[model samples]
Target: MNGDWFIRGRDGRLSVYLPTDDAVLCRAERALGGSWEPPRRLGGEQRLRPGPAVGQGADRYTHLAAWRPTKPGEAGLVHSTHFRPHLAALDWTPIGHPGKTGDRTGPPAVAVDARGRAHVFVRNQAGGVSMRMQKEKGGWDPWRDLKGGDVQGELAAVTGQSGLVELYAATPAGILHWRQEKPAAVPTLEEAMDASVRPDTLYALPTSATDTTLFHTDDSGDLCAWRPGTKPTTVLPSAGPSRVSAVRCELDGHDCTLLAQRSASGRVAFAAYPTEQESAGAWWTESGPQLPADALVSLTVDEEDRVMAATLSPSTGRLLISRRKDEPGLALEAWREV
Candidate 1:
């Protein structure tokens, strides 16, 4: 769940969202755990895109957003929330395009803050970014322009270590970032952080209460980690992959970050390292069967703290879950089709 395709609630059950061509489908762990119920379709009319970006708030609510066709050749964003886990999701709310008329925008990235507000960011047609967010009174505020130029692809948003919302967008120039000085405040664009990154490959993870680490593929196609104001450090050398999904979890009692990527040939690969310790080195291991190149993959931690990986089977188109083996390093159980 690059935008957190899956989220764990206070009850410790996992809920996952999938954006098929026309609608968003959902599945959740049974209340007692051990299995997932059948897929539940969250209705939408327009043809949808890849992500139904999801973020969980302090209230334990999971907010979901996605981009869809507003009209022929026009795209718009829609959202919903899982206020009560395992229950039906709320109705879809239309978040119109940034332009007065229809306009093109990239897939959404959502971040729910400590105060329970969800901030949504998208790359505007003008190569900058625009945002629309939920209001305090339970409705949405009008789309706001957080200016930028040279922004290339999808945006990234994360609630920073201080409970403030921060955003990142890859650009030919560098990675453009925006930060809220205070909670619920408008995000201001900061100095561009330098990185020779590919568009749509940027991902952010809060490494500490005050530090955030960025993961992206460099010009050479190597995955690199960069803390703002520092040089980018290679995490995994180039393997001809374009994107990756990551999650933070405890590994062998050590705080670790796990990464999963679908290779160019459609096989899933995994790697891990101590959180924020890129200098400690890391290695990539390709495992499991090959999936469709278009198939998206995600990494998440189960309630037991074991890393779990998920993807869709190309041939059967069924959802596949691979749980981490208990004995050691990132080995996975047989791919289970649920």
Candidate 2:
């Protein structure tokens, strides 16, 4: 029932998020200033970049991009996200759409790099094909219409880390990856691979090299952790039921990690994840046994780096900072009675 979290600013200041709208809010004192009012609704002509892929960069200023909808029926008439560097404005001007939403062939996702250089990953209506766009200071590079594969969900990044290491799902199949300069395509398809964990296995990553990917699958109920780079499966220490729903970056000076899942265990709960596997050195080396009551409906990190927050709505479902585990019989009741 406690919905509060804090963050450390670039100037060694602490900012806090108090309960407000029914949205996982993003605050950038450096960008938006100290104005903590309701999100300023842009002209209905403008919409958020659409998806969790939007992020704040490392520039002196805050950054996000916004684009106008050229065609009809697009998710956004104008798309906007944080800020970027080198790029004229974090905003974008579109060309055209492929066809419909809910289809593989649509628009590409807009993502920015550490310096705020803009890059996009998407699949157009052409069916069997994919696309990527890079934006320069003045103009943009040609769309490298890639035949690699379809990008599922949205995109994610960490400065120069996970952001550039593209992750997507290859239809009728599961997770795959596309790094900055490696082979353009990932190596798996709809092939049923053996994952020691299942259900809530995927997670909002934090640049871990060991098992960079996390997802949910019904291993011991719902489990979450990194997918083994060598094996076509997830390497999770045996843990009790747990599910990681949403995640946010809590800045401790220059270091950033994650605050996942939520717990009314009376104290804000957290688990440490090494940026890489070897970094995990025997951490979660064995799946720590927890239970399903660990599932989440939705949650976020506040200014103080505290893993505090609650449902966007008392009826939204569960917010997880870990893997999907058996619920400890706690669902969204009401803040008045948790």
Candidate 3:
């Protein structure tokens, strides 16, 4: 499974959730680029296939949601819990199943709105979407169907500046559909490509209060982005068939978007999309450290805009976490495995 489950806490620490043989493992760095705590198991005794979804609410608690097999040979069920950042130990609560029995498709995806409520989204077995929200008084609401037919991949959720939540899902026909939580809002479809794309890896970047940039890799292996009312822009020409992660950050005092993915040669590489004033070109391609080949990588930015990357080695299936050292320029030497 791809390493997409991660969240940067309000205190600037980075935590990642990974699936193991019998449990879900969580590893956290006390601070960006700092020493990491030992892995803590979070419920699940059966095999957890895809990774979990994690989000931090305004209340300073990090929420995690995931699905694990019900039995050795059965389908999976969804579960959730929240933990305090300063605590060394965890107390996981059971947030029951979001989908019907034998209906879970991918792991859950979560987004905490400004009201401090956690919203969880999951793809059902029938290729449709379902969601559940945490109540202000504490328990979860009943599952609500979002009802997108033939939804092709994992759902992505983000709360916009107006405190409105939006969701994105891909279709088998390479169309990206989005819906807003506000009344009178309906799902809007964007034709991202003419051919089918990898629907499982859709990512939405809320660049501003009113503007969001959606990113996804097409079937042809190109990294593409779409802003409201604009055509899709190709960010990386050939990101095909690899896991891609991106975050908006400041690079040398300039607002930029950083993208990390496994290169065509199988090694992990990073590129930068700096503001016009910071660069004459569109992308500073191949800027970060050289990492091991065939490793699945996940990228995130801390409160200070420093990039943290977690990589899973293909040979041993072990995870190695790294961060960019505080430096003046973007260079391979600036990244150190921690």
Which one is best on TM-score?
Answer: 1
Cα-based TM-score, every candidate = 0.91, 0.52, 0.81
Model 3: per-residue Cα lDDT over 269-338, one tens digit each? 6777762221233442453444466566777766766777776654454666656778865543344444
Taken over the whole model, the C-alpha lDDT of each candidate is 0.78, 0.35, 0.62
Error of 1 at 132 (Å): 1.5
Model 2 TM-score, all chains together: 0.52
Q: Looking at candidate 1, what is the lDDT of residue 6?
A: 59
Q: Per-residue lDDT of 198-251 in model 2, one digit per residue for the tens?
A: 322334344444224544444355334444354443333333333444353433
Query: What lDDT tens digits, residue by residue, belong to model 1 across residues 1-338?
Result: 34767567767777677766667778888873478888777644445666567777766688888777667777778788777657877777787777755655666789988888888887777868888878877888888899998787667788876888888889897788788888778899876877688988888888888877888888888999877768889997754465678888887788998888887667788888999999898887888787766677787777787788888633345677888888866778998777
**Candidate 3 Cα outliers beyond 4 Å, as residue runs:** 1-6, 30-33, 44-49, 58-60, 71-76, 85-99, 183-196, 275-284, 287-294, 314-317, 325-327, 332-337
Model 1: runs farther than 4 Å from truth?
Answer: 43-51, 68-75, 313-316
* Count of residue pairs whose backbone atoms collide, per candidate: 2, 83, 1
Error of 3 at 324 (Å): 3.6
